[model samples]
Target: MLLYTAMPLELVLDGIDRKYNFKEIDVDGIKLIIEPIDINHGKIVRLISTNPQDYLNSELSPGKIIEFKM
Candidate 1:
């Protein structure tokens, strides 16, 4: 199963991580490293990958809705 969110990633992920403590996610057969970046007011979510070119070519790129396996 896959779950997608249009809401702010930080809000949704922070809450979910607090409850479940998940560190990574699998989407489209790729394992993404999830990290949080603190800015001035709040934190933003960052998804890291070893093959960044592949990641950029995937549906998980910027301006696309993020999808994750549940």
Candidate 2:
């Protein structure tokens, strides 16, 4: 069986060169963590907004999978 069911993901930039710990997501009840990785084309970005702008802005890994979001 699959350990996790993939869903939509939302991430905010936390900071550069920082380590993030895995935790449960309030949106979908899935655990997730994001660590810094190579920059994508020399640019760092993340999912900064939700449908209703409920999530706050923070630095995050460019392609790190934080967790599943419904």
Candidate 3:
């Protein structure tokens, strides 16, 4: 499976409902919402990818972690 590294941009239980037109790669097609402070500046970015596996679904519940190309 393709891999993705996503950094939290904001964290809200129902954050998707707030965004006007957000798109994600989860089986449910919803992107996870996380706060920018949770991730390191050098980590991966959010959205901007067509590959479903290119992003880590923040809704994983236990919390999301991503690995990026060095």
Candidate 1: stretches off by over 4 Å: 1-23, 33-45, 67-70
Please report the candidate that would top lDDT against the real structure: 1
By TM-score, rank the candidates, best first. 1, 3, 2
Model 2 / residue 63 / CA error / Å? 6.1
**Model 1, residue 37: what's the lDDT?**
30
The lDDT of each candidate is 0.48, 0.34, 0.39
TM-score of 1: 0.30
TM-score winner: 1
lDDT of 2 by residue, 3-58 (tens): 35365333332365566542222223322233323332222233333443333323
| TM-score, cand. 3 | 0.19
Q: Return the lDDT, model 3, position 39.
A: 32
lDDT (Cα, 0-100) at 43 in candidate 2: 26
lDDT of 2 at 10: 33
Worst 10 residues of 2 by lDDT: 23-32
Off by over 4 Å in 2: 1-27, 36-70
